[model samples]
Target: MKKFMNEAGSLAADSLDGFVGAHDDLVAFGQDRKHVRRRVLSPGKVAIIAGGGAGHEPMHVGFIGKGMLDAACTGHVFTSPTPDQILGAIRETDNGAGVLLIVKNYDGDLMNFEMAAEMAVSDGGHRIETLIVNDDIAVERTARGTGRRGVAGTLVVEKIVGAAAEAGLDLFSLKAVGESAIAATRTMGVALKGATVPQTTRETFVLGETEMEVGVGIHGEPGRSRQDIADAATIASLICRQILDDLEPAQGQRILLFVNGLGATPPSELYLMFGLARRFFEAHGLVVCRKLVGTYATSLDMAGMSITVTLLDDASLGLWDAPVHSAALHW
Candidate 1:
């Protein structure tokens, strides 16, 4: 709760204002600060919009720019954006090729984005499609009763889908590409420490110095189990096993290995985990063709990291390599 904010009620708005001000050349606030969009819109291109709760910085918002998301609607900390906010983004960004909404598979996010899509078609006369990303393999379908939560693998979906949209792909085509990417991706995370919400002083969960939360969710949801903390190699092996077992890629499959820090982890440790994870995947007969390591998706200073395994083909690899200019990712 030691956040640098004047008040809890205005935390989201104030943060948005600062972010917009800093990246004024790259992005601008959507109607009434409901969302953030690329300052220079690409007319006639299929608009790619992604959004979810805040706290996971440089995510939906940071990915908004050339060759990526055209607009990103954000909710309050760890809260889903309203349907009205989503609809406004669609209406404002949709040029002529329609829009594609890249949503994570959280209950609030799914419902709100779906409602906005319906509204856009019926009320605004805009063609809209939605791609839901549920890449977290931490829980079985029965665990949360909402299927696996979308975790860090969302970055892979957004980048590939965004490139496709920027390349003039139609709404349906973009949806197909995004769906395939979703099908090929899987993610799992571990938490060394829980995050403290801006509104409260208590951490999301308490852990002893020697303990860790395995397969934790971005919103601090409980993972499969909590156990004694192990070394990086041991931890990386367990996580890699979960992801590879779920994804089930063929032998020699070229893959993109992404190591994402959950808010508080540092780059030095991130790279160490990445190195270990890469070695583990390579041992399983998978080719570590492309890799990304950074604090892309986070949970409000939670000390942990998630590993994402994405099976990549030539087309998808090209899309991932395509030019992108955003606050968090660029190439």
Candidate 2:
């Protein structure tokens, strides 16, 4: 509602323009104008392209750079990119080694990307594969029986898979790595305040001053439950427990812990949550092999955060630590 923009329907496009300009060092707007690709790409390495809607910053777009996605097709806020846009991304990023698409498990995303992949392969004569990330432990099915909704774990998929693609892995191997990453990951989020889309003056959802959604999705979707806001420790415990229940982490098992801000949550709060998460890990006898804390994936100005735990193996560990140069994450 209280956003700075030129117009309502044009927010996504205008914001993308700013995004493209700011990350000019690493990204360029595709000819189709609905996607982004790395400035420099390997001639014959497996190219990785990840995309979804626009509000989740430092996600598909922010992860476009060295050792990551070669292209990212962005839709409007919380919407799926069209098949034509996705096809354009496939064509542009496909090197001699082919291309891989990392899409969340949302129905629209799945359908659109699949259609685009088919179009690219049968019509464009390009080889393209798709990896669907469904690591949200919040729920197994929504009202539409669309299976699990993808959340922050999608970022984990991009990181490990991107590294493998950069290492010249074949298309099949790269897809396997992505699937493995998704299998090893689980995420849960809580929203203290709802977000307002740029097109409307109303918030996506209403929350009482002292109430919160215990397990929120990135698109302002309804979470599992709503309750009075609790302390950081309690909130962190609930999120960790929900994800760990699904993950079933073993004693002394290693994990890559990520505490992500949902746009409006501050670093101070996220670090506090991370501290509590670490305490919980210590109490559970789990070892955190790597730590990533920030707003890597975010809703549109939503005051919340998500916790993602990826049980890392030797291969994932090495790839997770691999060098990455991107807009949102770099190491």
Candidate 3:
């Protein structure tokens, strides 16, 4: 019930206004509060567009800069952006090389972005490609049911594919690289406390002083189950096991490990998680090529952390190592 914002106003516009004001060099405000940022539109290189709810800051918009996304659409907190907003971003970012929509696997996001893509094609004959990220291993897998959800691993996919596009890769080749990165990435999360949305002046979920939720989503959705609070090593072990079970990284393979904080979790806790994750990877004979630790992707005010691992080959590693300058992440 503790928040510091007016709850009876337009959350989306207010948030975007502040974001654009602070990062004018990296981003600009577009119609309908969309985020328009300059991108490297090399001839024959496909444009990249990504977006979703507003709480996951520095995600779609934070990534809009050199060697990353071309533009981003910002919806209300915990809600999907409308088709028109998404279409506007596509139109603004498109430079005749076609556009690629990087969508999360949430139901609302999938439906809305697909509708926007269809509209873009029907109205302007702009070729649009899409890559849906679904790397959360905590969710169920069924052909006819809601598959895995996209979590922290999405940033890695976007980073790799963005580099490919920046290097003037064609749409087909970028799609291939994107799909490969998506397939190789996996994520799992743990929540120590719940988050409060600005619109709702209350916590989304409840947790006792000595309990935690494993495999929690970024939007405060219920995770696998609650468990007694344990030490950081034990918690990291549990999360890493789930991700390793899903990905099965080989002994000699190089991997990118990301320890992401879900808003309120401090950097110290994230570093503790990273230490344990590094041990686990080393014990399994996996070569840790690079590691990124911070609140790259986050929930509103959720006190938790998520881990993402991407198996890397030479080409994937090269793309990931490319220089990237964005509002949230800099490399």
Return the TM-score for each candidate structure. Answer: 0.98, 0.97, 0.96
Candidate 3, TM-score vs. the true structure?
0.96
lDDT, candidate 1, 62-148, per-residue tens: 999999999999999999999999999998999989999999999999999999999999998999999889999987877646798
lDDT of 3 by residue, 228-272 (tens): 989999998998888888888777889999999999999998998
Query: CA lDDT, every prediction?
Result: 0.93, 0.89, 0.86
Greater-lDDT candidate between 1 and 3: 1
Ordered list by lDDT, greatest first: 1, 2, 3
Q: Which stretches of candidate 3 lie over 4 Å from their true place?
A: 39-44
Candidate with best lDDT: 1
Model 2 ranges with Cα > 4 A deviation: 141-144
Ranking by TM-score: 1, 2, 3
**lDDT score, residue 213, model 2?**
94
lDDT score for residue 224 of model 2:
90
